[model samples]
Target: MRIEVNGTPRDIAAATVADALSELGWGEARVATALNGDFLPAASRPMQALRDGDRLEVLAPMQGG
Candidate 1:
Protein backbone atom coordinates (compact mmCIF):
# COMPACT_ATOMS: atom_id res chain seq x y z
CA MET A 1 0.00 0.00 0.00
CA ARG A 2 1.15 3.54 -0.67
CA ILE A 3 0.78 6.09 2.09
CA GLU A 4 2.29 9.41 3.08
CA VAL A 5 4.69 9.28 5.97
CA ASN A 6 5.71 12.60 7.46
CA GLY A 7 4.77 14.17 4.18
CA THR A 8 6.80 11.71 2.12
CA PRO A 9 5.27 9.01 0.01
CA ARG A 10 6.09 5.50 1.14
CA ASP A 11 5.07 2.01 0.15
CA ILE A 12 4.54 -0.56 2.87
CA ALA A 13 3.12 -4.05 3.23
CA ALA A 14 1.71 -3.60 6.72
CA ALA A 15 -1.93 -4.13 7.58
CA THR A 16 -1.94 -2.25 10.87
CA VAL A 17 -0.17 0.69 12.44
CA ALA A 18 1.90 -1.61 14.64
CA ASP A 19 2.98 -3.61 11.67
CA ALA A 20 3.87 -0.48 9.75
CA LEU A 21 5.99 0.72 12.61
CA SER A 22 7.96 -2.50 12.55
CA GLU A 23 8.25 -2.41 8.79
CA LEU A 24 9.56 1.15 8.99
CA GLY A 25 12.05 0.23 11.69
CA TRP A 26 10.24 2.14 14.40
CA GLY A 27 8.97 -0.86 16.34
CA GLU A 28 11.11 -0.33 19.43
CA ALA A 29 11.36 3.43 19.25
CA ARG A 30 9.22 5.69 21.38
CA VAL A 31 7.30 7.92 19.05
CA ALA A 32 3.97 9.59 18.58
CA THR A 33 1.79 8.58 15.67
CA ALA A 34 -1.11 10.25 13.97
CA LEU A 35 -3.21 8.83 11.18
CA ASN A 36 -5.06 11.02 8.76
CA GLY A 37 -4.76 13.92 11.20
CA ASP A 38 -6.05 11.87 14.15
CA PHE A 39 -3.86 11.03 17.06
CA LEU A 40 -3.40 7.32 17.75
CA PRO A 41 -2.44 6.10 21.17
CA ALA A 42 0.26 3.49 21.57
CA ALA A 43 -2.06 0.85 23.01
CA SER A 44 -4.42 1.22 20.09
CA ARG A 45 -1.69 1.00 17.43
CA PRO A 46 -1.94 -2.78 17.26
CA MET A 47 -5.61 -2.50 16.40
CA GLN A 48 -5.42 0.62 14.27
CA ALA A 49 -6.01 -0.29 10.67
CA LEU A 50 -4.30 1.52 7.82
CA ARG A 51 -5.49 2.03 4.28
CA ASP A 52 -4.05 3.14 1.00
CA GLY A 53 -3.45 6.89 0.61
CA ASP A 54 -3.62 7.40 4.35
CA ARG A 55 -1.42 10.04 5.93
CA LEU A 56 0.81 8.96 8.80
CA GLU A 57 2.82 11.32 10.96
CA VAL A 58 5.52 10.01 13.25
CA LEU A 59 7.23 12.26 15.77
CA ALA A 60 9.93 11.26 18.16
CA PRO A 61 10.85 13.25 21.23
CA MET A 62 14.00 15.30 21.02
CA GLN A 63 15.94 16.21 24.12
CA GLY A 64 18.57 18.88 23.94
CA GLY A 65 18.75 21.78 26.25
Candidate 2:
Protein backbone atom coordinates (compact mmCIF):
# COMPACT_ATOMS: atom_id res chain seq x y z
CA MET A 1 0.00 0.00 0.00
CA ARG A 2 1.02 3.65 -0.48
CA ILE A 3 0.26 6.91 1.26
CA GLU A 4 1.60 10.38 1.80
CA VAL A 5 3.56 10.49 5.03
CA ASN A 6 4.34 13.98 6.35
CA GLY A 7 3.92 15.34 2.86
CA THR A 8 6.23 12.77 1.35
CA PRO A 9 4.96 9.93 -0.81
CA ARG A 10 5.99 6.48 0.33
CA ASP A 11 4.88 2.88 0.43
CA ILE A 12 3.78 1.40 3.72
CA ALA A 13 3.14 -2.21 4.66
CA ALA A 14 0.53 -1.92 7.37
CA ALA A 15 -3.20 -1.27 7.53
CA THR A 16 -3.36 0.24 11.03
CA VAL A 17 -1.14 2.68 12.87
CA ALA A 18 0.26 0.11 15.26
CA ASP A 19 1.00 -2.28 12.45
CA ALA A 20 2.55 0.52 10.45
CA LEU A 21 4.90 1.44 13.26
CA SER A 22 5.84 -2.16 13.69
CA GLU A 23 6.42 -2.52 9.97
CA LEU A 24 8.55 0.61 10.03
CA GLY A 25 10.48 -0.66 13.07
CA TRP A 26 9.50 2.33 15.22
CA GLY A 27 9.14 1.90 18.93
CA GLU A 28 7.96 4.24 21.69
CA ALA A 29 10.48 6.86 20.69
CA ARG A 30 8.57 10.06 21.25
CA VAL A 31 7.20 10.12 17.76
CA ALA A 32 4.20 12.42 17.50
CA THR A 33 1.83 11.16 14.83
CA ALA A 34 -0.97 13.22 13.34
CA LEU A 35 -3.37 11.64 10.90
CA ASN A 36 -4.67 13.95 8.18
CA GLY A 37 -3.93 17.17 10.10
CA ASP A 38 -5.67 15.83 13.20
CA PHE A 39 -3.78 14.86 16.33
CA LEU A 40 -4.34 11.28 17.32
CA PRO A 41 -4.01 10.23 20.90
CA ALA A 42 -1.66 7.50 21.98
CA ALA A 43 -4.56 5.24 22.93
CA SER A 44 -6.01 5.47 19.43
CA ARG A 45 -2.77 4.78 17.65
CA PRO A 46 -3.03 1.05 18.19
CA MET A 47 -6.31 0.82 16.34
CA GLN A 48 -6.12 3.75 13.98
CA ALA A 49 -6.73 2.70 10.41
CA LEU A 50 -4.89 4.37 7.56
CA ARG A 51 -6.34 4.76 4.09
CA ASP A 52 -4.86 5.60 0.73
CA GLY A 53 -3.86 9.28 0.45
CA ASP A 54 -4.05 9.61 4.21
CA ARG A 55 -1.61 12.13 5.56
CA LEU A 56 0.66 10.96 8.38
CA GLU A 57 3.04 13.10 10.30
CA VAL A 58 5.48 11.27 12.55
CA LEU A 59 7.91 13.55 14.25
CA ALA A 60 10.55 13.02 16.87
CA PRO A 61 10.54 15.18 19.96
CA MET A 62 12.94 18.04 20.34
CA GLN A 63 14.91 18.45 23.53
CA GLY A 64 17.50 20.83 24.93
CA GLY A 65 17.48 24.61 24.74
TM-score of 1: 0.97
- Model 2 clash count equals 0
Best by lDDT: 1
Evaluate candidate 2 by giving its C-alpha RMSD to the native, one decimal.
Answer: 1.3
lDDT of each: 0.97, 0.82
Per-residue alpha-carbon lDDT of candidate 2 for residues 19-62, written as tens digits (9 for 90 to 100): 77777777556688899999887789988998988888888789
Look at candidate 1 and give me any clashing residue pairs: none
- C-alpha-based local distance difference test score of model 1: 0.97
Candidate 1 residue 57 C-alpha distance from true site, Å: 0.3
Tell me the tens digit of each residue's lDDT in model 1 across 1-65: 99999999999999999999999999999999999999999999999999999999999999999
Could you estimate the TM-score for every candidate? 0.97, 0.85
